[model samples]
Target: MPDLSLLDIVNLCDNCRVHQPDPVPSPYDSERLVPFYLSESPDSPVIGLLRPVIVEQLKLENQRSRDSGQRELWALNVDESNFVSRRNRPSGPSVSFRDWLDTHTKRTVAMKELCERWRDTLLFEDVCGPKKWREELYPVYADPFGVHDHPNTAAPGQATNFVFEMERSACALFGVVTYGVHMTIYDEVEVDGEKTLRVWVPTRALSKPTFPGMLDNTVAGGIGSGMSVFETLVKECMEEASIPEHVVRKYTRASGAVSYFYRTSKGWLQPEVEYVYELAIPAGVDPQLFEPRPSDGEVESFELLTHTETIRKMRQGLFKPNCALVLLNLYIRLGYVTPDDEPDYMKILTRLHGTFDFERW
Candidate 1:
């Protein structure tokens, strides 16, 4: 196969951006999705985007619950064309999605039960096939652009801007913006008296559900509900790479984040944000101290590759789509990919941070 250009690598992650006219044209747009609202109020925030199939399923579920004299979980406002949490009480006003989940005593339990029930259905099998079921819950943030603060707060929902938690497997089904942390760990070494960086990259375990046997970042994991970015980073470092907390805390530096709207091959929407980090080990430090070993079955093995080799593999499509994006961001930050050499430098930079603003949808 021919080598992919740097822009091609970026396009792989942010492929949705390459498709024009925003909302997508009809006939060919069977995957056009609708915004999911927190409440029936016009001002309520859009917490997710829902594909037509999922929306139809939800509508049917709502009808069935209402017909059986059970509480309807969702309210479909025809006038506004959005889905919201149905008012549980007849006398009281409708509650926001966050309040409904938090006060109903179920919290995230209701959603979990729903997913479990759907696990046996054809719709579930189609949207999130067997290989994609992560059995993990990912938080849905109300304010997508807001800061995720109060990481250590004792209160259940006070720590972050999350409204509710859904199965990670079903996130793409709901078209929610999922958050994760990716750390590129590398060592600066002197080669013939010149400083060069060698990065540690991992191959995903073949038994893994998604992107099995694909190249991945040194350490990466989703930020589960109630977990802070740093907390998730430290945990992933140890769990995925066997790198202890102290080494991570000392060497890892926050290197901003990459946001992009991606559509899976199955046509499911995935608007995601990956918090990027860099772990730089100085030239004189013992290499063995910072080296990564696969402690979790999620990774097959770890390999240290030079900068050139890393870029070559990336261009060859050896890396997972988003992982390649993280590597591209790393190269840009390290001064290896710049405006002078890369003609699409500005375009690449903008698309790297392509926030899926609701208005654009």
Candidate 2:
């Protein structure tokens, strides 16, 4: 979602007033009531709702949404400032960080132990450590322990350009993240008459969520929604495929962002950013069967799709919208299809006519 400030909304409302008739009072009329309302926050029942409402309305107006014209309404009844953590608290009595670490290091399950130890070490009993404390743990647990830093830290000099949409009652903006991945396999197999290459996608899972914004969007500490493309891929690989570190770190052909899209969610067309990456699996190993995931309860089933099969599935709308774009881009990269290498849809639509871009929620 895009963000807007109160002044921005005032200017917009002013513009709306110019083109359309003022029905009741100016939307900014509440601005005049804020100072008085805040003064009575201690006991005024009306002040409790009214003061936060004014501030939140301003926040909503400033927020980035898919719809520019309608995003203002999200302010209506939202207790925007009351964000609470849904994380499960530790069971049993709290212990010192060092004590927790001593206990966790003996545990057999590495990921859970590490996470519990980390939470206790970082957030328990006022560690009083600087934000940079996370950097110390990065090398220790980042990949192997599933305690990795998110790609929320954008590289210096990088800037984001937003895509905005307006709905009847709300609006949002599209934000993109640059992402890359490489897949490779090496093994020997018999060809027509002699030993030959059996190039295949070595990844165990074919359809796991990879993009960032597809899951969560709350911007924290300068990180916006759709910020963790690499992290998301890493997470998916870990949970769905059990891909090892050596395999993930293996160098192979790196495909730049081939293309991307935003599927407007249904009902008011809430906006969402989407991204795609393509990589070739080097010749040799046999493709692995993806086991159905239990930790990630949402995974249905996984299957390997050949280049031809993947394209057919994309064309048939059998894939999720983001997954479809990923498959289409993968097809183009593998020479199963050709695209203009531009991000715009019309160019590709012109090249491959009678196509459909699936709308996702």
Candidate 3:
């Protein structure tokens, strides 16, 4: 059953206001889908490592949505700062970063490990020690495209944007940043003589630390050190979905990216970029027929859902943060949601890209 009943109202941000739609009986009706609430984070005081311009750029995106004059966009505007995360964040741990990052002083176990490890490796220095550090047990995240670069690093401070530890990246220490890929998979469906889309949604294994047991894109993995974008996509596809090399190479197509500075539970910053892809699972065949289990333990299972149901669950805050952003990108690019459908269409486009200055990187 769709969660549309409860999802009828949403927020662009906590402070943004809401206008409810006329209640409709049939959940699938597109007319009723319009005028729903959207949760978009608004700008406040400067925080983390982002510059005022970059931060304002993000707020402008939300401002467009808020400023939309009674457009029939999905999701209505709402008020107050409480319940902010509920608008977009997939259900997870309690309100941690959205509230405590400003007040909390202690780091979580994983974050402490990252901090200690970074202190040992001279993360702030430009010495050759970084190379030797990579040989150790630490993670090395390389941002070749500099997609995670930000403008807050001070003059003459070009972003090294290379070799980050897994724990550190998770902790967002010293304004450290990283990149990854999120591929959304879908199959074409002909429902009642009309063409529609059904997405392949993956459930993350409950053992994972972040957003465990939450819904995710079909295959999403960090673009680890030394791998190109396509390389990471193919590797993740095989591991997470049991997709073959041939299928990945032929079926996976780049679908741009969704970039944001996500605030995680442990108070670590995530100035991250998720290079998005759309993998079209051939209509007649899926990985299940050929592979009985996932090559990796990250994913628990895969389920195909209609686009309506997918969005409905997403509004219910069931999708992982990055996963939800990736899905929104797909919705925008596929014409399922349009300028008419979204009041802040252009802002949404700009904000989703989360463009960073490559020249400084």
Candidate 4:
């Protein structure tokens, strides 16, 4: 929220106490020229952090004036364009997105190599001493989601935690994506016999565009953490699924199973925050009433599935990998199915693509 930029850091470094300016005779030959030096407000927070070396740098700049025979030889000028993004018209990083992506690609490749080396070191260390291996090599190989072991031996717990925390912070920008599940119960005339609970999925649940040009092939994606969980949920619901603004507000309830995720994508491992909610449908409201609105034309078809049929569909990989798992868990947790009823979670297992795996903490 602060208006500070990188220039503020650079300028702070440039101006030092040793750089006081010296007076010179005016060219007009009447009055002596008063040497000017860079100055800033005393109340600025940045002023306190200035090290002695920075002050010395500033002093050198000030002395340069008299040597160059100029009064305003070393002046601090705040760059106006330092903060703005060229493509997006926002003020942030100096590097362009293309450049940033390229750098990320290189980093990802390097990290992959580093992870491999760490893995090899760990394997070698494991043969020597188990205790030494855990202490020395595990910390370095650990992943953010705790998938890998920490390879650093110095301080195993602290070092791994530090790395995981750092990795989580680095990739937090991509945000979260989640799916909502709903079921409509249709009853027959009989009180005990033939009733059906039909599961309905929104055509467009949550998604971000991977390619603007190939909207038709675009997958459902959501930007998480940019807004609060509920805010993001509502926004994504509207964007991908075409949940009517009023309808979403009306049926949405806080079902309270918030889960935390640390996701790696595009070479950054971001923190993903998400929660689930279930809203009761009014008696008159039909599940068929809602139509799927594809975000990037990713919707194949929308159909209602019964409990047994849903499980069968899961086995056939009708949904996204993680999405299928999430749906299966939701169904089991919500009592739509029994825990003993193990649906084919394998259907949800798909190779993760387009996401960068973080090896470095």
Give per-residue lDDT, candidate 4, residue 346: 29
lDDT of 2 by residue, 98-128 (tens): 1122222221133233334434565221221
Q: Model 2 RMSD to the real structure?
A: 19.0
Ranking by lDDT: 1, 3, 4, 2
Kindly report the root-mean-square deviation of model 4 from the true structure over all alpha carbons.
24.6
lDDT, candidate 1, 1-361, per-residue tens: 5799888888777766322433323332544456676765546666777766777777788788889997777755433433333323112122234334443226367777677777756457855555567777788766887866433454765545656677888888777789999999887667899867789999999998778899999999998877889999999999999998999998889999999887776677789999999989866778788889999799989999988898899889898999999988898888878899999999889888987755544
Better of 1 and 2 by lDDT: 1
Q: For residues 214-290, could you state the per-residue lDDT of candidate 3 as single tens digits?
A: 88888888765446678888888887888788877887789777775443343223556778888776656755543
Candidate order, TM-score descending: 1, 3, 4, 2
Tell me the TM-score of each prediction against the true structure: 0.87, 0.36, 0.56, 0.37
CA lDDT of each prediction against the hidden true structure:
0.76, 0.28, 0.51, 0.32
Using lDDT, give the best candidate's number: 1
Model 4 lDDT per residue over 195-221, tens place: 544555434323312212211101123
Candidate 4 wrong stretches, greater than 4 Å: 1-192, 202-221, 258-273, 286-289, 295-298, 340-361
Angstrom error at residue 257, model 4: 3.6
Clashes of each: 0, 24, 13, 28
Q: Roughly what TM-score does model 4 have, to 2 decimal places?
A: 0.37
